[model samples]
Target chain A: MKGKLYGIGVGPGDPGLMTIRAKELLDGAQVIAYPVKKPGEDGTALEIIKQKVDISGKEVVELLFSMNPDDEVRKRCRAENIDRICGMLDQGKDIAMITLGDVAVYSTYMYLDREVRDRGYETEVVPGIPSFCHGAAKAGLPLMIGEESLAVLSMAKHDIGKVEKAVDCIDNIVIMKAFASIREIADMMGRKGIPLSNATVMSNIGMEDEYVGPLETDRKYGYFTTVLIKKKVN
Target chain B: MKGKLYGIGVGPGDPGLMTIRAKELLDGAQVIAYPVKKPGEDGTALEIIKQKVDISGKEVVELLFSMNPDDEVRKRCRAENIDRICGMLDQGKDIAMITLGDVAVYSTYMYLDREVRDRGYETEVVPGIPSFCHGAAKAGLPLMIGEESLAVLSMAKHDIGKVEKAVDCIDNIVIMKAFASIREIADMMGRKGIPLSNATVMSNIGMEDEYVGPLETDRKYGYFTTVLIKKKVN
Candidate 1:
């Protein structure tokens, strides 16, 4: 019998935030795969679940997902990841591919899941708390209220003009990967009449060194940083 | 000693989708509160968690959240709910207020949480899977990938022109409460050159009677229905 593939979301950094279903799947998973920025380094998804689930005698695969901006390079990396995952499935080992947040939202596992299913492997995606949601909760802020809309975007890919338009049109906005563009985003929001107080920048959410407050133009941000901008309530 | 407030998200509709934190809170909760459309009706959030968490001995409070479109009426109702919740808190009873999706995203519990905190009561929010994320997973669709942006809005409150602008700018869109405006939105999408194939309407996600497919212009949808539209990859 061919082993099934489970695309599990480990949630934002907190193991306590992990869903019961994800925990149950992790407990039973024989083969676990998680994305790493580089070889020989542990990924955040794995680190979050390690304390809660025992992994003795289990096969763990480190899938390298580079931060290269080239489409060809990323495609090649995804193809190789699928091949390695399929190989484990051929050995009749059920593999649980862990992702940092929900697999459906800008997650590397989404690409892997599509390829795995296209190759005729039975794949299931288990949802987890997305990072932005956890960040909003930690900041004690609501992402969007009744009748309000929210726009979630990554500053790395979207044009500044597009981001500005989103800021004007949407009631609430969550900008991911705002490390490089925080200054620009803050400037745009200011130009759009959105006060700095309405924007909350959170990094390393649910972690010991988490920051939640107004975005500082001088502060450096890591990859896990997210900025939430809520339009002033009228 | 004053009692703390736990704003728990039951998650879409599936008990299995609930987080470990929510379940633990529910299991140990002294007072359980959930919003109902009417006094005698059981809240959807309560129904979703009832099977997994034992609530036989818990002091259950049914908070009426009317679906009135009038802003004043809704505000009055919310104020009444907060008063009642504070009453429980005054008795030194920790109250676990249950909501359908993540409390941070378009949840009534957000309002209550703000008011509870303003009243000097300690409030804690536990995250749960949002309906759009769960619906996307169930339909084997990615909410976003790479740098693609997503806009989540409710059709009921947004003007058609604003919705059109969002659909035009955002890479992916999730429209909640699309029941009444399904046909109009479909027409708008068609005019904007977004094919019906790119849009999927899912109702009652994680429930027994879930529907995931192209939006039918003729079929009537319930309040639980969510329409997900993805921009065609060029």
Candidate 2:
């Protein structure tokens, strides 16, 4: 029997947030794979699952998925990772590639899952709680209550105009990867008459060092940071 | 000691998709409350949990949360529901209010949760897998690739212009409540040069009768239907 590839979302920094199916897959899988920016770096997905499941007997593979912007570089990295994953599947080893959040939402596993499936391998994606949802819950913010629309944007590639439009129109906006352009986004929201109080910046949610507060444009934030903006009630 | 209110997200139709925390809370809670359009109606949240956890001895209360547009009627309904929940909490009965999909995103429980919290009761929100994430996974579609932005809109209350703008600009769009305006939204996407092939309509995901296919505007869909559109590659 051929082995299957499971893309399991570990959820945002919480072991309890992981679905029962994810935990079951993690405990039973012979080979566990998680993405890392570098070979020696610790992966968040691995860290989250480690808290709940024992990985002492499983073969843990760190798939290198760099944060490089160069397409050629990223393509090469994905190719190598896919090759390694396929090699394991060929050995009839069921591999579970754990991801930080939901696999379908801006996850590196999506690319790897697509490549594996295109090569005629069985693949399954188990949805986990997305980070934005966690951020909203932690911040005690209601994301789109009663007829409200929500726009989730990654600031890494979007232009300022798009960000402004989202803030102006959408009832709730979640800006991911807000590390670099958080100041700029805050300024834009200010220009658009969006109150600073309406925006909450949360970093490392569900972690010991989690930070949740009003958006501060001047402060530097880590990559795991997210800004949730709820339109002010008139 | 006053009992706490746990707002649990049951996820989309699948018993396996429920988080371990949600299941634990469901099993331990003295009272289980779920929203319904009317009393005696079986709610989707209740149905999903019924498949996994036994509710034989637990007090099951179906809170009426009608979809009526009249503000006065909705307000009164919410007030009554809050009163009942507070009464349970006052009696030191831990109440677990189950919602379909994530409670933090577009959930009726948000209002009830806020009301409970404001009335000096402890409330905790456990995130569950949102329906759109499940829909994307079931359809084998990536919601946001790389730095793509995602917009989640409810067509039940949004105007055509807002929907058109979202389709035109957002990299990924998930349209909920597309039952009434699925045809119009399809036409708008077509006019915006977005290929119909890029859109997938999924209904009752993870359920036995789940439907996944290319967006067919001609077909009538139940309210559980969702339209996921990934922007056409240039």
Docking class of 1: medium
User: What digit string (tens of lDDT, one per residue) describes model 2 on residues A1-234?
Assistant: 779999998888888899988999999999999888887898888989998899999999988887788989989988988999999999999999999889887888888777899999999989889998988877766778767788988877747787777766677888888878887877887798878888899897877677899888877677788888878641
**For model 1, what is the C-alpha lDDT against the true structure?**
0.86
Please identify model 2 stretches exceeding 4 Å from their true place: A218-220
Backbone clash pairs in model 1 (N, Cα, C under 3 Å; residues 3+ apart or in different chains), count: 0
lDDT of 1 by residue, B1-234 (tens): 889999988888878888888898999899999888778996788888987999999999889988888989989999999998898899999999999889888888888888899999999988888999888888878899877889999877647787888887888999998878888888898899988888999887756667888899998666689999888742
Taking the tens digit of each residue's C-alpha lDDT, what string does model 2 give over B1-234?
Answer: 889999898998789899988999999999999888877886888988998899999999989987777989999999998998999899999999999999887888888877788899999988889999998887777788776788998887647787777766678888988878888878888888889988899886766667899888778676688898878641
- Report the Cα lDDT for residue A217, model 2: 80
User: Which consecutive 10 residues in model 2 chain B have the weakest lDDT in total?
Assistant: B202-211
Candidate 1 local lDDT, A57-124, one digit each (tens):
88888889877889799889888888988988998989998998898888888878878999999999
Candidate 1's C-alpha runs over 4 A off are: none
Worst 10 residues of 1 chain A by lDDT: A156-165
Q: How does chain B score by TM in each prediction? A: 0.94, 0.94
